[model samples]
Target: MDEVQVGAGGATDFARWTGEFEAKVVARAAAGDPDWARGARLDPAVARSVQRFQVGESGDGANLIGKADRAGDPVYSAAVRLFIAEERNHARLLGLLLRAGGQPTLSGHWTDAVFVRLRRALGLRVELMVLMLAEVVALRYYRALRDGTTDALTTQVAGLILADEQRHVPFHCQRLRVAFAASSRPARLFAVAVWWVLMVGVTAVVAVDHGPALRQFGVRRADFGRGVFGLFAVIVPSAIPLRDPVRIA
Candidate 1:
């Protein structure tokens, strides 16, 4: 059987993504860890924001892996596992950074708990849709963290995560495009409409919740909201066939 017929579509080959993920792993190993010894410092508001994000990064990977296994593709399943590892590594890096800053990681965050539960109730297709929302928001969040901060260590970590996230968008897009391949025109429209709404809601929450930190780093809350929306509009259509990607003017 072909790979696309199994948990993929729109000419997306999970094998290709798998290869890319594998290469990333190799590159990451070669690059070694970020200069963690350099230490990091953040304002109180920023530290709080980073702590919440750190909690968000460390998530229920087993839930996603189970869904991927049920999707019936070993290659995709392997890739998902690798993807989970990358996320785990991110959490670890953030935790170390927090310690370096003389702060403790939060044991739990209510929003992360809710987000994890929401994704657990979804199938691989819908789960990726929800996960993509976080990914897009993260792209902007990390970018701001990278460019807005004066801390070298924070910038390094943010840049590393941002590069991985840039790859993640297209990785999911290929599969989501496949998942929506069979939907009718109206169905696709409705799904996109609902997705856009959810995206807006989540982005708004993040902007408000992290407002003080963003402001401290010189990012306006409204601008963060606009940035993710712009990024989302561009890629949203790529996940659904029969629609052109929206251009942000």
Candidate 2:
């Protein structure tokens, strides 16, 4: 794999991200998982919905790691590994939450399968772009889970994953800003346009697929889609600048 070049003086420092992820590792080790003995009471609709998200979060991330390593930024590669670990932890937490509620974790889901295929079909930049759609969607979905649910254990678990995801959007943006720093304006615009299209399509699928659970959470399907696009509106400019980014850090 060839290195994705960023113009000199424009490379975003990823050491900050590495340090943040490391600090999180320490903090998580200290704080530990939410008490599962308390158990959870999930609506059948919500449980089915969470089962699909758990599958989305579960992956080896070898392809992403390999691409990061070949991108020639050890600090960024290290940060990406930490990022993947946190995602896996989300899957674990969700699985545990489901078990505590007497629901079984799913082996797979068609939606997750489609996302994995789409992400794997591209290079590092494109993969991250595809991934950002999921991240943005998760930001909303988890927030709804955290705030809209009456289940204490579910709220706690969603809060934890939501916090990590809040950081994840900007972390990916920092790298993406650098990735696009050398591209032409028209190219960046084209990429952003495509990203928006993908976001709309994916959000629509999720909104329909999870509408029942979202209703249980008191969020309408239209509102869920709106919230996802709202988050994405903020992310696109951060990741893809129409004018050259002044600084990515």
Candidate 3:
């Protein structure tokens, strides 16, 4: 349980998130990994659920990396590279977890394929906004796996991934703040409005798509959607959101 070093002289070295991500790299290396030998057990519904998530996590991230490089911010690019690595690691961990449960990683999911294509079509700022939707949903999904499941190994894996995601939300938010720093208020508000709409649609799709596994983990579909909505509400305003992210009841 050794704490991950966040670099020396902890006086907020991660003004741009590179320091924080670096600390995560060191911590993950030092921490090694969950004991895979213990194996795992999951319901068929949950196994399928994990498979879809594994595919989502397995993206190469070259697209995002290229965009980050184009932004001309070395620090942000560095942080993004590390971020991609973490995401890759998530895929790896889930793949191994699937193996432990005697399951196989999915080749691909249509939703992810379309999602990747859409992200590639957008600028960095917009792409990250889309990506943030996934991150927000993940924060809750992983929590359900960790807290709702009785399986020890599953809990361990979910806890680890969840920890990374918790950091990811704000990291993206800070970058977004900088990305939009020069935008006029009206423009920023428009983007926020559009972003809110996307978040809502994606949340509903995920809630329905993963509903079975969520119920197995004691989460209702409505609850899942609401949880994401609450998180998105806070995130929207924090990241120059459009008019406080109205929930519309």
Against the true structure, whose TM-score is highest? 2
Error of 1 at 230 (Å): 0.5
Put down candidate 1 lDDT per residue, 63-170, tens digits, no spaces: 999988988879888888888888888888889888878889999998898898899998889899999989998889998999889888888888888888787888
Q: Candidate 1, clashing residue pairs?
A: none
Write model 2 residue lDDT over 130-216, tens digit each, in one string.
998999899999999998899999999999999898889888887888899878898999999999999999999999999999999
For every model shown, what is its TM-score relative to the native structure? Answer: 0.92, 0.94, 0.90
RMSD values for the candidates in order, in angstroms, are 5.7, 5.0, 6.0
Residue 26 lDDT in candidate 1: 97
**Which ten-residue region of model 1 has the weakest summed lDDT?**
1-10
Cα lDDT of all candidates, in order? Answer: 0.83, 0.89, 0.83
The residue-by-residue lDDT of candidate 3 on 188-241, one tens digit each, is: 978888988998899888888999999999999999888888888777766664
